[model samples]
Target: MFNRTENLSLYIKKYPVISVLIGMNLIVYLLGLIPGIGNNLYALGIAYNYSISQGEYWRLITAMFLHGGFLHLLFNMFGLYVFGPELEQLAGKLRFFSIYFISGLLANVATYVVEPLNYASLGASGAIFGIFGAYLALVYHTRKILPQLKQLIIPLVAISVIMTFVQSNINITAHLVGLAVGFILGMFQFTPKRIRRFREK
Candidate 1:
């Protein structure tokens, strides 16, 4: 049964974007593990505010795919795997990509603005937070479809708050900004026509 569940069509037909994203992240991570290539990649793309100021602007996006370690990669990928597909199916591919990438960039920008000059970070936490915020918005907009999600609101917020304080390395600025951006975007009332048709299947 578990094997059958793993072979479900939603992964292939509905969540191609998520599959591609995870594949890209994993490929980059593997490449980073090769000798000498790691430093070069980090130098070119990691989100060090100082490096970004010097005109390596691509770091803003590249950093989203770069992980600090295996556990970092695992957590971020897990979040994406869990939260991404339903939202993607609901919003359609283009809008889903917009929410993920745009919110991530804005989150990095917020971190740069609020944190110290020497501060540096990397990972998809901000993007995941955006997805989380988007999910919150969806739950608000379509409460009747998945009313049980309402139970998650307080715990999610409380956990975010607690994690921000307890974990010194976590980027609270990025997380909060991403969540705010996603929430605002989600308020735009964008239920894809495909979602309705797909659900009827």
Candidate 2:
């Protein structure tokens, strides 16, 4: 029989950065569950165009850790669990952190620019999409080494993007922008020749 706690412990040890990120998101979510705090947290955490224009710049980063509900937290964490550790392992801790935060903040900023003045958004979907996009770039750069990854990863990302249309209260703009940024960053992070040379050294 498998022990869930034990498994989680092992996973945390194996992927310290991802574990810390997940822990941070979960901690913020739990803190936001308190009665008065949730609304206040949202006020600070949600990225609204007007609020940002008024100097609420921190929302760009804070929004990524806030969730509207348990389901939202679960879905985003599931994505992080599935994609984060592997990417962190490949990119190393600093670069992985860069990809996650930079792409997430940029995604929110992009949405702020294009969305309505009253529009507000929060969640980790942008960062998760960035991770997905990075994977696509990794596959592209290493196609010769892992030719089959192209077929598998591309369709997966495409389908997920398509599914976003049927959903409500989701920011597709943020998702796309995050993905684009991640893909662009990945091109540099995982170039085949570069990786191959690193491996050789």
Candidate 3:
């Protein structure tokens, strides 16, 4: 089953933009290892209490690239590495990029609005979830042609949603909100007309 999916390096070759994004995220992670500089870099994430409300709205976007710790960064980056390339290939570079940034921003916004008094939240999970959502949209949109993908996409989404609920300190709200927003955006990207045109072409 897994062998049916394309290799990551091949996918990146086909979609260079996603490669650059992955590189950028990795670069940011590396920067976060520079001793005091790393600490300062992390401090830039959207802190609901002290930082975000202080007009650091850019953190909504920036925080997507910042991570709390090694494991935190690893998981988010791994998710992006696995899913983002496929999404970019299916949606086209521009549309895929749009979904990632917008969904991530919405995730951060949801976090800020819902937990205005909470401490800082960071990582690319929102954006990664956006890619997952885009994958769902693409698979659903192309269901007639690629009916088999439903088995993969649907189960993955279900598992992710379940994990969101079961995990402690997992920022359930951000995950839910991000997923919701991503699904909405994915729907638009995979509108019937667009899908038909894409398939026809």
Candidate 4:
């Protein structure tokens, strides 16, 4: 079901939220390339715990779009490009955007609460993990229909978590919280039976 067969225009038409987000990330990254301007945006956008506590709450959202470098942006956007469309199709655009955006925001919030005051970070990894978590929830319930996804997602999550620790300079707090939040949200968003349970209340 996850395939990259569509051209750029068609892909965006099919998954506009994903397109806009990826575009936003690219635009922000490009802005960060401007000599004087880039540094300013970086300072303002990076998720520094001290700044966040001091009331720069916008960083939580901005940090999700900001990247330390091209490779960071490339890897994240690529991940989104690869995995985002199916969820968008499954959850519909608005809910899909909610899962992605909320995951990233809370991930930054968790980092602020849990990390050292001096801690600073930038990237879309948390949001990406959120997508994974939500997809995981869906794949799990529908596993009887699509058995391969369980096999795929479990190993993927484990490996991602493992690398989160083994790799230096990674924000473990954001990743874990994002995953947890996504899974919880997914429980509501992806499951028709669960959604009906809530609506009946």
Model 4 regions more than 4 Å off? 193-201
Error of 2 at 62 (Å): 0.6
Residue-level lDDT for 161 in candidate 3:
89
Q: What would the per-residue lDDT of candidate 3 be over residues 18-135, giving only the tens digit for each residue?
A: 6787788788889989999888887765445457777878888888887777788778766776666656655787888888888888888888888756566877788778877776
Rank the candidate models, highest TM-score first: 4, 2, 1, 3
- Report lDDT (Cα) of residue 52, candidate 2: 92
- Write one digit per residue (lDDT tens) for candidate 2, span 123-167: 988888888889889888877787887787888798879878878
Taken over the whole model, the C-alpha lDDT of each candidate is 0.80, 0.85, 0.76, 0.87
Q: What TM-score would each prediction reach against the true structure?
A: 0.88, 0.91, 0.87, 0.93
Residue 11 miss distance in model 4 (angstroms): 0.4
In model 3, the clashing pairs are none
User: Which sections of candidate 3 miss by over 4 Å?
Assistant: 1-11, 196-201
Which clashing pairs does model 1 show?
none
For all candidates, the clash counts are 0, 0, 0, 0
What is the Cα-based TM-score of model 3? 0.87
Which of the two candidates, 1 or 4, achieves a greater lDDT against the reference? 4
